[model samples]
Target: MIPLKDNIPSRRFPLVTLTLIIINTLVWLFERSLGPSMENLIFAFGVTPADLFQYGLVSQLFFMTTAMFMHGGWMHFLGNMLYLWIFGDNVEDRMGKFRFLIFYLITGYIATLAHVLSDPTSTSPLIGASGAIAGVLGGYFVLFPHAKVLTLIPIFIFIQIIHIPALYFLGFWFLLQIFNQTFQGAQSVAFLAHIGGFAAGALLVKFFQKYRY
Candidate 1:
């Protein structure tokens, strides 16, 4: 199932969400322009647990921030940006632009930390904005459980769009992450980062409920 959109509308302009989308898109384009040379970019910017643990300084700091912009592939970038565009506006509308931006970065950093903790020795560089976008999903799930998500369900070659309850869709997504992370044992993709960002979003929303405005 692919999410095409959602029914929830924001009362205010989600500048932060839009800005983040632009930034991510630009970064992806830049990496794509590099073609085979993108590996060099990933090695420099993408998070590597081994580098963090060994170098333990500026390299780690750069990766912690840069990792959020680096993505493994086209689908990876589109899927994450789609989720952010769908759910991020509502959260940003409630939290205000600045706070929402900060919240996103914090959850993203926490997600990266979770990835590092899981595989501190792996040389594979962790990349993608899903972890951060997962946080937006997490927050939206909490704040608007009843919201409707318009999704495209594919059956063989047939495709149909339907609206599903936010709780059901988001809940299923989260559970799938946990299930995959547990059974796959961290082989491909940082499923644990998704879980961590989701948890962070849920907890952070609780922590600053009053500030949600």
Candidate 2:
């Protein structure tokens, strides 16, 4: 099921979330402008466990933070932005602007660390905001478990729209990430990062959020 939107409306404008999306979009555009240099950029900005360990502390921190804003392709960027657009606003609303922004970066760092720990020797550059968005999902899951999400589910030739509770939707998503990471092993996608982000989000949201239940 693909979530289109959620029932919980933001009490205030999601400044941080919108800003992040704009930044991601602008960065993606700049990356495309690089053409041949894009690969080098991703490698330089992206997080690789080997590179993180090899680099100095400052460089490692740079990669960890910048990696969240980079994406591999249009679909990658759109998919991550879509989730952030939907779930992020409500989370931002609950956590307050400044706290939500910091929370996002921290969870993203945690997510990257999770990936690095899972495959310390892998040299592949891990790009995209999937892990960070997964963190948003985690926090949203905690703060808005009962919120309804309008989702699109494709069945063969037909498309069905379903209203799903955040609990079940996020729960299934987290489980799927874990399952894929366990079964798929090493692949292009960082399933471990997603799981890590989601887990971190769920746990961190409690401390970050102002409202309860």
lDDT of 2: 0.89
Predictions in order: lDDT: 0.86, 0.89
Q: What are the per-residue Cα lDDT tens digits for candidate 2 across 1-213? A: 789999987878889999999999999999999999999999888888888767744678888888999999998888899999999999999889998988898888888888888878889988889988999999999888999999999999999999999999989999999889888876788898899899999999989887543
lDDT of 1 by residue, 1-213 (tens): 788888877888889999999999999999999999999999888888888778874657777788898887988998988899999999888788888888898898888778878888889888888888988889988998999999999999999899999999999999999999988875668998999999999889655443344
Question: Which portions of model 1 show Cα errors greater than 4 Å?
Answer: 55-59, 208-213
Please give the TM-score that candidate 2 achieves against the real structure. 0.95
Give the clash count for each candidate.
0, 0
| TM match of model 1 to true structure | 0.93
Q: What is the lDDT of residue 208 in candidate 2?
A: 88
Candidate 1 has its poorest 10 consecutive residues by lDDT at: 204-213
TM-score of each: 0.93, 0.95
